[model samples]
Target chain A: MIKSVAIQGVKGSFHHIVSQQFFDENVNLIECLTFDRVVEALITKECDAAIMALENSIAGSIIPNYALIDNYNLHVVGEHYLDIQHNLMALPGQTIIDIKEVYSHPMALLQCKEFFKNHPHIKLVEDKDTAEVADRIHKNKLKGVGAIASVLAANIFNLDVLAHSIQTIKHNETRFAIVKRTNSEVAKEAINKASVKFEANHKRGSLAAILNVMSDCKLSLTKIQSLPIIDTPWKYAFFVDVTFETYADFDKAKSLIKIMAEGFKVLGEYKNAKL
Target chain B: MIKSVAIQGVKGSFHHIVSQQFFDENVNLIECLTFDRVVEALITKECDAAIMALENSIAGSIIPNYALIDNYNLHVVGEHYLDIQHNLMALPGQTIIDIKEVYSHPMALLQCKEFFKNHPHIKLVEDKDTAEVADRIHKNKLKGVGAIASVLAANIFNLDVLAHSIQTIKHNETRFAIVKRTNSEVAKEAINKASVKFEANHKRGSLAAILNVMSDCKLSLTKIQSLPIIDTPWKYAFFVDVTFETYADFDKAKSLIKIMAEGFKVLGEYKNAKL
Candidate 1:
């Protein structure tokens, strides 16, 4: 059982919420300000596991996070999908008209940018964290300042949510991966999905031929992302997420792909969190 | 010939530099603050062509731009690759030690994040545009403020260069697409690369079969990005760039893939800009 977790942000942040829901609420949290620091904490055994956002339905994959996970050789233990909700909050009893400036994470600002188009009077400022901004507003009693964060942030900081779910897309869902230094501890019977990375040979049709192996083994490709191998400009490493009905099929495909593709590595094998 | 071109920033941004280099220096520039506005100016005929950055070597694909091009039915006339260099500039007389804050476009700040690690005393702030901040510092005579922008921006704004090529990665490159409402204007003899979007059937290995067809036609896949089809939960639309030795090979593969893949559309057909 996991006891301590490393998250990129403090309490009331999305990563914190994931840690609470994925593990027990009483779990100890080692808060980090950046993804690199989170990885460092995990590598040094400061925490037993780390929670990292892998992909979002609307924003797509967080490519750098994928690089971090791969470069650090971390393993995915499980996954969680969270419906992201951005709320406009401020000191209680103040209206939107009273707000002169808003501060939050740069990404949260980007998501709720459309709502701000109508209110040209308010200036948007990017801060380090979403919930941290909320905490600052409440502690300092900043009246004219607003924040784009989550409902949990507003509740914890005693700020009134002036607007709810202000993100442009209604169905904004982010997939988070629970990672550790060790390989997955999930049981084979419960494993329905796996994330793998592979580099195809320079020969033509090599990538397609490898995909054929997965299909013949009854693995369903859910996601495929190609990241260029930095040193070798044109060549690419393919990161793919596949789902299977049976573990036996996945095992066969894994063995075949390892032999077929260059630099083949299993990033993770865990339960599919989608359904 | 191209007359007015729409770009996403002021005269000294990377996009602005691309506009001048891709077109002539005498071409007209319609400046917009956001990518959405850049698309609006293009769709509304405010400009003849718009330059959009498709992918960065370090950051991977800018996924939303692909969606915008596909949704607006824009045609890719050509592609350009730019070597990005970020410089730190400040008002005349102020040194790096004197600078208290650095303001720039979020992307510029992100790219040069590693350089600022040693200067923990300096605060990094995100702004609307990189060159605009240089202009602001120049006009307002902000003594202790620094700007992270291009060399063109520093020259245009008459700011002293405090540091050169401060981005974490030295060989960073970004690929740009020259898009217009009509089809590609290049001659067939010069065309060696094409960008195509397709959705495969929900059957197993449908995507692999499509790839097999491309390889059979001598088309070498260069870049492939999969964006989730919003309405369909697990389905994805693949955006791929392929290059060939001859245009006839690309044409044959295009026809075959069009017949095999669902929603197959050519986003752009132009000369490969890799070289």
Candidate 2:
């Protein structure tokens, strides 16, 4: 049973929300500033598990986090999809007119760029984290500062929301993975999705052959990303996420892929959280 | 005859370097702070063409830039690969001991993270661009500030290089694409590569079938990236780069893919720079 979880930001972050939704509300929170630190805490047994964002619908894959998880040999035990809504917030008495400068994560600021054009007086500064900025504004009582973060951050940090859903795209979602140091303990019958990494041979239709095996085994490819192997200049390792109706289908496909592809490794076997 | 080229940063950025190496050194440079503005400058005829970094050897693809190019209907005429070297630069006569803060682009700061770990006293701040930070430090005569940028930036800003190749990875490379409002004017026989976007059908073997088509046509797949179609939640538009021995093979593959796939569009056709 997991009692403590590590996340890549302070309280009121998207990772914090994932921890609450995936685990019990009373679970202990271990805050980490960077994804590297999150993995470190898990590996060092400072936390039972770690939640990391894998991809965003708008921005695509967080490739570095994928590298961190693959390099650290972390397991994706579960997954959660969070709807990202950026809100501009400040101290209770402050309004958009009163705010002089806004500080938040660079990605958040980019997403909310259209909203800021109307308020040309507000200067945007990039910070490390979104919720951290909101927390700072509340604790420091910074008068003319605002933060772009989730609504939960405003509630948690006691800041008033000056604007809601200020992101340019209203349908932004991020996929987060619950990772552990060990392989998932999910029962076979309950497992419907799997993440795997493999390198195809340098020949024509090599990747297609592997995909054919998955299709023949009745597995649906949900996501596929290719990352260049660091030591090898031109070689690539393909990271794939597939869902199936039965665990036996995935099991058979995995057996065939291990034989067909080089450097075959199972990153995770988990329930399909998207469904 | 590309005269003026727009880039995402000042004259010393990787994109700027690409512009000089790919085009004539006498070409005019129109620097923009954002990729959106880079496209804007090209679309509005402020520059004859623009240079954009497509991917890095260390980091994966710059996904958002792909969106920008596709959305704006920009054409990629050529590509170049630059060996990236991040240097620590400060005002002349200043040593590393005197530097209290280091400013650079977030990506540059992240890449050179291992080097900064040894110097715990130096605070790392995220800025808009690496060359811009170097220019600021020099113009302001900031004594205790350092910027992690290219050696060319240090030279252009009249700053001293405190350290060379400070990035953790020594073999860093970035691929930049020269984009313009019109397609490549290179003769058909000279074109060896093409980038296309297509959406596979919602079936088990649809993607494999498309890859089979490319294989049968003798087109070797160089790169493949999938970005979600924002309106359609789970569906993805695959951005693929393929190199072939002859233009006839790519032409054959293009005709077949147009019939087999949905929303098939050619993004670029040019010589493969990696070769």
lDDT of each: 0.90, 0.89
In terms of lDDT, the poorest run of 10 residues in model 1 chain B is B200-209
DockQ of all candidate complexes: 0.63, 0.60
Best by DockQ: 1
Per-residue lDDT of model 1, residues B1-275, tens digit only: 88999998998899999997889888899999988999999999999999999888787888889889999999998999899999999998899999999999888898898999989999998788999999999999999999999999989999999999999889888889999999977899999989999996445798888889889998888877777777687677999888888999988998898778789999989988786
Over B111-218, each residue of candidate 2 has an lDDT whose tens digit, in order, gives 999999999999999888999999899888999999999888988999999999999989877888889899999999889988889997446777888989999998
Candidate 2 positional error at B9, Å:
0.7
- Residue-pair clashes per candidate, as listed? 0, 0
Clashing pairs in 2: none
True contacts kept of 1: 0.53
